[model samples]
Target: MSHLTLIEQSPDPEESKRDGQRHSIADRLRSMGQVRAGAFLLLGATLAALAWANFAHGSYDGFWDTHLTLSVGDLQLDFTLHALVNDALMAIFFFSVGLEVRREFTIGELTTWSRAVVPVVAALAGLTLPALLFVLVSAGSGYEQAWGIVISTDTAFLVGALALIGPKAPGRLRVFLLALAVVDDIGALSIIAIVYTDNFNPAPLLIAAVGLTAVYFTRYLQSARGLVYGSLAVVVWLAFLASGVHPTLAGVAIALLVPVYRPERREVEHALELARTFRQSPSSEYARAAANSLRESISINERLQSSTAPYIAYVVLPLFALANAGVQLNAEILASAARSQVTWGIIVGLVVGKMVGVFGSTALMRLLRVGEFGPGLTLDRLAGGGALSGIGFTISLFIVALAIDDEAVQNEARVGVLIASIIAFLLGAVIFRISDRLHPSEEIGRTLLRPVDPTRDHIFGPVDAPFTLVEYGDFQCGFCLKATGSVEEVHRELGGRLRYVWRHAPLTRFHPNALAAAEAAEAAGRQGKFFEFERSLFSDQEHQLPSHIIRRAQELGLDIERFERDLRSPAVAARVRDDMLDAEAMDITAVPTFFVNGKRHTGPYDAQSLIRALEQSAQEPQPGSSA
Candidate 1:
């Protein structure tokens, strides 16, 4: 049989079909989590609220203001319909936010101090400037404490706005705005916990702390039962509620305590082995063993995030908008709000303040050499993104409800939020349109692979192989580590037909140990053990440490003194730096970026995908050849 036929026949038909079905389900779930779907849901809910409030004012008011009460024997909890949505239902929304924040800190863009500095500093500036502007505009207006309304960015609306702007918007711009908004939410949450609480009660606070401690300890258990966690979460939320702290904070605390690491590499290998056995024997017992092992390979943190995100986006947030975005636009209320300082304060704070704060601070950072914008993000695009940040709707409404007691002031603030959101969206859309005309999409045109040098880089397989695969990767990146298995599989299948090259693209800002790891790999290459060192590094997490590097070097039977000397040599560091420079020139923003036959490969990096690409390349004429 041909190579393709042989590869296709390697896996059992039933197992492949099952795997395909599972992947289809995952893809559908991910599609539902897109920005457009969430945005449309939120918009639909807001429009429904507006129609209900304006067309049937009395019924709307009476229905939302209806009291809801829950009791367990002597203990009772009471809240109005609107308050129930804000205080109780919104906890789920905050829980999703907490999970996202934890992910960002652990593995996403904000994983390191340097990677975080740009967005964190920008968010701080974004918050401070808006609050200052609000205070200045509302001075002597008896609404100074409502400055919290101006400090948050509505991530849903902002993301939606970007989506509306279309694919002309660079991916890096989206990432930048996301990091900034998450950081902004963290700041806003801190303010809510510290500045808005009404009373202090130590007894309930102690109980909440105890609950959090219990939740934290659950991470160490081999199997954390959901029922146990749910009970503890309730205790924490109730304690915080009675202690005068916002109960939503309990969500954040619980999220931080969840473990985020996957099972060991050996365990993953064993799971694969079990899966193979089940595929061959087709027994229920083996299937169950393989299923459990596969489940354990993924982290609970990721599982929770994937499972809960769709609900929070589609249900919780839309419900919040329906309950709170209903501001009656009657002539009398409009006339009053138009003349109110609170309205102007919020408008100016959101529109003008956000623009100056985000763009200005970003510019200042570049000038000071403290931080720089990511690839494909220009100053004009940044300015437009800043304008979009001003579209603060959800969190601003949430805070206005908490901060303002006077019905008149609350109405004024709500009107400001609605009007300002419109103006900001228009302004941002115009700027992005202008940016699109000025700097059209250039990613595809600019992504070409540099010619490989055998003397400077590590290579595997035959040098004259018809297909070449170059990976620009960071050793510390989890995705890159995972890609190693796929790389090995391609090499094994292709044999002498493929040449595989490795280049260092260590994201030093995000991965602090990546630079050292790169140097060690290069040092081992000098001792004719580069592929061995690379395998050792990817197979275990311990290779990230210096002592582990030494141990690995000894195991590989390298010249100890020469290896140590080369690890610190300027030449080794230079080679790594050169690869990074090439990556930057190509705007390779993420790790495990692959190039197939001198063209960037943008699809999935699974073994199947790589093999297909190689097969296609083999059928094509070689570069610079006349067939």
Candidate 2:
């Protein structure tokens, strides 16, 4: 036999193989308890971000504002204060936004004209009104630059606020808000491109234009590759950056140009033709001849789009948020922004203007007979809901920093954002309270904001195991090694009744190996050794066992040959990629997270918490029925 077929490899199995695998009661309780702990941890991180920006390291308030230079010999990119954040980190955010835009325009809620119009109109109003208001108020020499500040809405902050409201929000209202947001985002992009670009260079603009055209013309490329788009996007961003237009706009341009529609007709016809050829002969030689032709005709467009979306969403967006959202503030800056009209205009524009513009535009859309109006909501409720648009803190702050070069302008803008956001929240709360008191309706339940269900297909399998435990862990995590004890305990305690499912919540910023680790584990699972391989993975903790783990798989009596070959397969990488998509859909932000019997858990579990969860699960009925 050839050397290629002789290597020992780990077995590949499905997650179903581990179904009903028993686990300890202690692991169950710990997993359950950590759900709340995870929430606290998430909250703590948010608070820490705010506090760190506002208080600690007051001396370096201008650290992020300081100029940084990146140069390649004669080629250099220099930016200062907030431009770097908006143009650099925000480019990744824009990239994510671009992906979302493509998804929506292609096949999402915005696929149809009726679905798209209301939001587009509402987005227009949301964009135009606040910007006009800001411009009107801050009519100084550089005041016009602040126009984009009001036009942009922070999707993260808006979505986060809606999540906090839980059951209080209606489904129609949520849909309306989402549509309006899409519109608002488009408006923001326009403002950045049209209003923000100062001293534009024609050469770079021309190059960017050509790059965009290339993406559009090659839209039908059967072998359309993400790397092509990525590389071109980088080039466009660089050109735009050098051209004096914000680099982030490159993300939008590249995104718009990338075609989302698949060449399905050709693909299907080709596949059929290949199938016909295969049916004619059973010989390996014939099979190879037919398969090669089919493979050649096979387009990677679907795979390309699928692969790109998750990278932009989970990897790029989060990293951008982490890098750019760390704003430093102090008493002086806060006070300055409190008193500055330009700052106040941005604050008022985001908080008051956003609410008014968003809600007003949405209301107008309803009146204009454009899309359906939100049910169970009156004008008062709509107006109140609009106040929540003040949650544009992130995008507002980002734009404010970009709009002004002066420290005073930026500080004042930040203050306005803070104040307006708080006020908006209060206004929204009051409206919700009044709406609830006057016309109580349970039609819109609290589950609307819950994480998207992952078990719809029994995607993992039925949890008939005695100990039902779900883990929110990244495969490349070291701390999860300590977590193995809890997993083992639950299996031991509740044999056959326990089901453990692994989830991907990789932290790309902290650990680079996480994505690969997840793929490896999934690949191992394909060969029936997920649990064993996962144990080996967690055992190392620091995640230093990629090659060694493969070597160890050989020792574990695995088919090291097939296993090693499959480990590097795109299918394996795609599995990890799929998990990442699911993770994003489910709103998982951190790693080492767990959920037992529908309850969330975080970090490593000790004995006591584990037992408590299992005991509690014992009292509760099985989770199949709707709660």
Candidate 3:
């Protein structure tokens, strides 16, 4: 579940139209599984910690206990190695989380209340039940306050777990989980800020408030943002540390104040202007101005999140696992933990409580007509996701450190965290297997991924047409061009009874101009000439150049400036890419792949064959009956 969209890769203006869309490289990179790789790194760290603690318990303890000091001309800061990783470096981790939360609320999963309510309510239930379970199980254990441990979920590991489980086209479920996890993080952070803090100093908080005020206004500044934000962030962190607040809170505070916005059209156009000027007269001055313009066009929140996510995932998180996951397991500690209420409380709260809390609340919400889940997010899949949510690692261990001061108690809690994570993953795997069996998603390519909507789909005929034919076609394909004629013949014979829908499945690897042409159709669609542009591109397929595409738009009486702007917009690129990805997921590797009433057409796609199929499908149970 990620709002992480593929980065926009504009087709080169200098290349021949046949050079095609270059997103195949990006698709290859995406297939390499960055999240899966990062998850493995974290798991490796956790395992290494276990091995070190069990093999050389003294070194594991002694190393983490080593005191480190930072001095800046009489301003001295001190921390044990373990504290430095958890308290200082993890502030950056929290900062990244804060960045995601801000982006998500503004533009990602939680942008609208209607779209967000189901997951938001489910997240609250997930948080509440787990903590209550922990409190009840740990009653009279002298550490019921450690309820925060069960309230959180390790998002990194949760995502990785989903990837490992490999559900078919889990796009909707991923979106729901992303929204739920964002709320879950917010709940965990609240618990940390409100429940665990001590000393309660208001004096330094005034200073922190002042620093935060400065941060609020830093958005208006045009340069040295890195230096400014870094300096101010340190000041704020120090202020919070002195105020007896967990200093990581400063990260959230700073991030919330940092501006987040879509790149302005004017700003992007101006950046392009600077870029053109630089190309005409290559100089350091022009280069710097263009660079700043490009950077300024995008918001700092996005830039900061993208830049830091790698380090946070690869370095900071692994270091956190190393410092916190080193529970020295032995006969005595194992026996003690087995009997410890805190241990069982954590496991039950996570492995059992989280599942019931998340999935049960979501199901109840749907039953009560509170909100809707996107298609494909069945209760069965949610059961699996809820089980995965129980893998509470990072924040769980962090809370263990803060809430339990006794070494023995700390060890017991850590043991519980580790065991719970493993059980949650295994249990989630089994649940997903059962879910997959029941749903039978294995027939992916045999049917449509999502039903066509009149608002979102490109169509030609009545919205309530009795017969529908959907084509996943490439603009540059000769076979697709042939199929279009057959489709026209079928439409002529069928009249308003048929609605033909076009979706992109651009074979960019072989037909470079295909992706660009598809995007051009979308761009033209903004001005009511999509089908006209499609016919023009197909009629003169060999002339499918950047110049040709623009000329076609002009000949169709499209506003040149508006068309150009729309052509390069991320929305346009994402639209084409979404179709491409959808096609890829359904294994639609070739052009002219047709789905007649949600079932893939076989044998031939000639007018006669398509007509017969549509006729037959009219009588069969139809999965893609139009609105």
Candidate 4:
């Protein structure tokens, strides 16, 4: 879905986690685990529900149907276990979804029309065509109103499925999918609010509006912001519930009102300063302030997401699956489902219709030159992702309860949803297998080995800049030193249109000090001075001594002890080794190798040649792109 974003590729690019940040290694690994574990948990829960319902049908029904009561002062609210999961718990889940949606619109992929157009159009088409297909297939099914079931995509499942599918160079595709998923989520939440509510009451809605207003203004509160927001959220939810609107929408309203922003550098520095003080003094009071400062440095939307994500992934959604997926299967029910148009409609809409809507719209946009996919996100991967978009699980099951009150008919829709999800996964798997095989790494010796990671890579321009120039050069090589001027000249001319990346390919065979110099550069990078250190190294390319390296650090005013330690550390050495390994993989045994927009450049190394190559790369269609 995000694969549709980027105004270019809609993928996550979290790619709505897409302003193009992988964050840190810990965050990336955590997110990956959460996505995978959530998907697998859902799968396991769905299977467990199905198995339990069939084996112990009465108990399954009894457990979820048991009513629970909550009393707040004089007010009393009663809910079945199923209702509690669906309304109260899922509201938190929806709130988490809303945080992501708001973040994307504010600073993620949907921040600009140029970045958001394709995904918005594609998400709309994805929603539209599915509804159309559902109506066409189940015209006489009496459950036509339930077409909303297939209008949403299960993004978590889609992303997790992609991880299992293991397509080559999935970074771009993943990002694009993430971007589109953000838009798709917006559509789904909107559908929930607009299509499902009945017997709308104006008075309570007015109260909800006021609560939402309070929520908006609470951001300005200097203290007790959380307490005020929590109270207002309850007020809004109660108002919506009383007004006959979905109470879960309160989560979204509150989330939208909560402010979101990237961590300001100045604030981060302040937190770091506090951290240093805490480290020296080790006082509880300093610790408290430091912790609070660190927390405040990040946006509340992110903080809330972080706090809530574990519960949503591990508890909320699995319970949802257990509650919603328990459809007791019998011969008669299975037979009726097979013959039921409602079942068939859900199947057709999700499996076939979602693919047609997502992929077709993407193709149309590309043909019209309105937008394009990112590099390494081939048509095959796009198609595969499109197919996976059909795996509509949570929402489909959710709407079955809302749109169809007949338990038997709900069972049929659930059966359709499960079957459609299976088919979509299989279809995506097949497409990935065929397409990835068609484009192997061996086919392109001229392409960069890895995608640009804004956090890790030494980048000199905007990470999302359309054109990227990657240079793999040895620091001590005379020719490599000479090319620095050319690189600078091109960056000066291209401005924001180009991002320049420098990678280490230290030719130790030719220059004995090159590897040490590469590691030294990385050590300087830890102190945020890689480029500056690089220029100093190039200016005195003949410096072949350890003392000279230390002298350069002294000259640059870097922390001498830390630099000295990092100069000997394995991580710094490994960082340099990574670039060396990439060079080896690309079969580069030379002083300087350059890649423009992931494609290696051949011929002259002058500023004019490099700029011309960059311009050419910008104009040319990248592999896996639908340009």
Query: Which candidate leads the pack in TM-score?
Result: 3
Q: Candidate 1 on 348-387: residue-level lDDT in tens?
A: 9999999899999888887787864544556788889899
**Candidate 3 global TM-score:** 0.84
Give per-residue CA lDDT, model 2, range 1-627, as digits (tens).
Answer: 000000011121122113211221233235334333433333344455566666655533465558888899998878874466556767766765776677566645476676577667767777777777887777773667677766776665555454454224243455556656766777777776776678878788888888888777665554545567667777788888789887888877776665554223234445556667778766787677666555544333334445554454344444444334454556766666656678767766777677887688767767777774523345666776688776665566666656678865665666666667677777787777787676554322211112224332112333444555655566555545556676777667666766667655554545656655666667677677777777777667473335555665775678877776666554554445444444333334344445556554432366457667766766665442221
**Local error of candidate 2 at residue 484 (angstroms):** 50
lDDT of each: 0.78, 0.58, 0.83, 0.79
Task: Give candidate 1 regions above 4 Å deviation.
Answer: 1-33, 166-169, 281-288, 442-444, 447-627
Ranking by TM-score: 3, 4, 1, 2
Which has the better TM-score: candidate 1, or candidate 3? 3
Error of 1 at 317 (Å): 0.1
Each model's TM-score, in the order given?
Answer: 0.72, 0.55, 0.84, 0.74
lDDT, model 4: 0.79
Provide the RMSD of all predictions against the true structure, rounded to 1 decimal: 10.5, 15.9, 5.6, 11.1
Residue 556 Cα positional deviation in candidate 2, in Å, after optimal superposition: 57
Q: Name the weakest run of 10 consecutive residues (lDDT summed) in model 3.
A: 4-13
Error of 4 at 544 (Å): 26
- Using alpha carbons, what is the TM-score of model 4? 0.74
lDDT over C-alpha atoms for residue 178 of model 4: 76
